[model samples]
Target: MTRPLALLALLVPVFTAAQPVAEAPVALDGTHQVDLVSEVNGHPYRLYIAPPEGYAADDTTRYPVLYILDGRRTFPAAVTARAFQDIYDGLDEVILVGIGNGEQTFDAWFSHRWRDYTPSANAATDSVVAVQFSQDPETVVSGGGPDFLRVLREEILPLVDSAYRTTGDRGLTGQSLGGLFAAYVLFEAPGLFQRVGINSPSLWWSDGETFATEVAFAEAHAALPAHVFLSVGSEEGRSMVPPMERLAEALRSRGYDGLTMDAVVFADETHTSVVPAMMSRTLRVLYGRSE
Candidate 1:
């Protein structure tokens, strides 16, 4: 209490500077990243998971989680687009998990997806068409849909649910072949996901095999208890629109009151360039945020 004048003067600057430096709060945007790795059916998968803001504070709160195929390249845009939806339109925020095909480069991803997303093509027929020198009737390096679906249903979904605050509802998003896989899932394992976004699905795959399957599937089930969003870019090609329309028509004809469907073709958009807008619209639509 009896400090000298010199000591008292020195303590003033120390006290001011010691006030925690008043750092600028960092202005965090409330985002976090987590890596989930697991082995499924002899293949290893790395999933990038982003839980929405306020995920951790309440133990009782749960949100729907979306599973994205081709997640390595697409997850960034998907999450950002969802964020924009949340900010601008007050959309319900959910968890985003992208399943990457383990390819860090472009070419590898193409080949890898062909093997994982397409339905199993007959080896005998493939040999004949492949010999034509014109082209193989069978898809190249294709036919792995069943196994990949197994991975999603058995391994990925369970693990993600255990780790994150996910609710009973689930959503799926994919493009092209991945979209084809989503289409197959709509029939093969309809109960797995409540919302599905199929973008420019390669209905051309396996010589349009999915069309026949869709017809059969709709015939069997009068009302599918799920929401479906189908999208294709106007400039993709003539063939793209018809198959998608046909599938939509097939589903609608079922007269299933539980089924909700929306099909749109964004004008002036091409295959490669359509993902961003499609992904954004998909989030808004399937997540019930669309105006």
Candidate 2:
């Protein structure tokens, strides 16, 4: 499996040398792209969109939409994975939309994610908020998740749903803190997305406080109205995954209706190398045809 660019690497120097000297140009079999600007709550965001393979200006075939967080860093790989699975495994072709920081530079994009992906400092998620990118306080943005989701629900989703043929079946994919945000959405706005692929979620964030939120959600709702695909590297920090297991067990014990969920730990994958296979596997489980 190819390594997905770890934003943490871009922020921390110890992982700097792992990055390639030069970024290769992105090439794909069937893809389309558009750049968009969104101003929500005084914050401007950059959105990079890719409609499904063979999309037409006048076609009425509504397709599933996949919203990828950290678009600048993850879009190319997602486009390629979507196309490959759509063809080889007979998965449904999807509308791919990448949400990026308006800033095109890596440092800025990486930094901005900290602000957009983390939830606000509630008593629950504040105790363990450790800013890793302390060397540059500027790179460590946190607790702006609600505004970011608003941009998606109110701005980006409406734009695509209006312009393209869409089924309104939305799926979200993100890593680390982005994964944490996705998990938050599962409870906070369970109706917003139909499918979610949360890879290597930083459950360690805030000492995995989200686990309590999930349990509370399960108690409140009789059914979870989404398909969820969760994954983590087997070697990810020991504390990172046990919470996910407990979460899965809790959900399983509830027997919630309309919910099909699975969590897998890739045997040999690490945080930096899990995303490509993670996305590929996640798309298959979420949308691919079963044998």
Candidate 3:
């Protein structure tokens, strides 16, 4: 019996090894890529668009759009999370538009994101980030956020609207520096997006310039008619957590009519580890079906 068992194990290994291998990876369904150039900044962008399951060009049903920042790293996660939420939690379906810089290397991607996401150029903040990443401060150039926003408004939005059937209900989500950019947009042009998700934002940028932006917005505008979801990891440290909580508090204290804001701190999660949970929760909060 022992000899037969040994022979069966060897046969099992041989059989498993004999199985055919796939020639190529299976692509995600209903997903397509679009390469576009930003007329505002002259930067090229790659959009990874994932339409909802069962989407069709001939179908007259229009869907909402969710623009995701850091598309290269976050797109797949967003797509998977959205699909699962829709399947299991009865979440509403929306088109996912991931904006990527088309960088092949991590260093190139890092530099490009730093340039586009920051609201202002600060040599002091640049030096700190440079040291953290082992990069030279001179190599990191920021202050392109305004232009990037223009690229989104004048270029990307039009392209997306023209290419797809959309309901004009827009959502924007980002993490870290991307989150910082989202916050900038929320204050700079609150009307652009109906839903905003800020996850682990680097509010420490430019000495908390985003707070000043918020103050300015609140001064001029009586109400902000948007759904804002703010979240952070409990382990993201004082620099991230306290500032985010402060922002939440400030927004709450304003008593802005028509503004629905929710802030959450996920325990046992770090900045890098909390992304999936944050994304999932953001979608549920912002787009969950009404009971």
Query: Candidate 1 or 3, higher lDDT?
Result: 3
Tens-digit lDDT string for candidate 1 (1-291): 557887899988987886555667331255434444445557567787778865775578989999999988788888788777677665676888888856766556765676678877546644653465344344445577888888888888898888877898999989987888899999889778999999988887667899888778777877688889999998889768677777878777778758899999988999889999889888888885545
Best by lDDT: 3
Each model's total of backbone clashes: 0, 2, 0
Q: Enumerate residue pairs that collide in model 1.
A: none
Candidate 1's TM-score: 0.80
Error of 1 at 1 (Å): 66
Question: For residues 47-112, could you state the per-residue lDDT of candidate 2 as single tens digits?
Answer: 667776678877767788888888776777777787767667567777787777657665676657
Off by over 4 Å in 3: 1-26, 136-138
All candidates' TM-scores? Answer: 0.80, 0.82, 0.92
Q: Candidate 2: which pairs clash?
A: 114-141, 115-141
Tell me the tens digit of each residue's lDDT in model 3 across 116-156: 89988887778788889987677688899999999999999
Candidate achieving higher TM-score, 2 or 3: 3
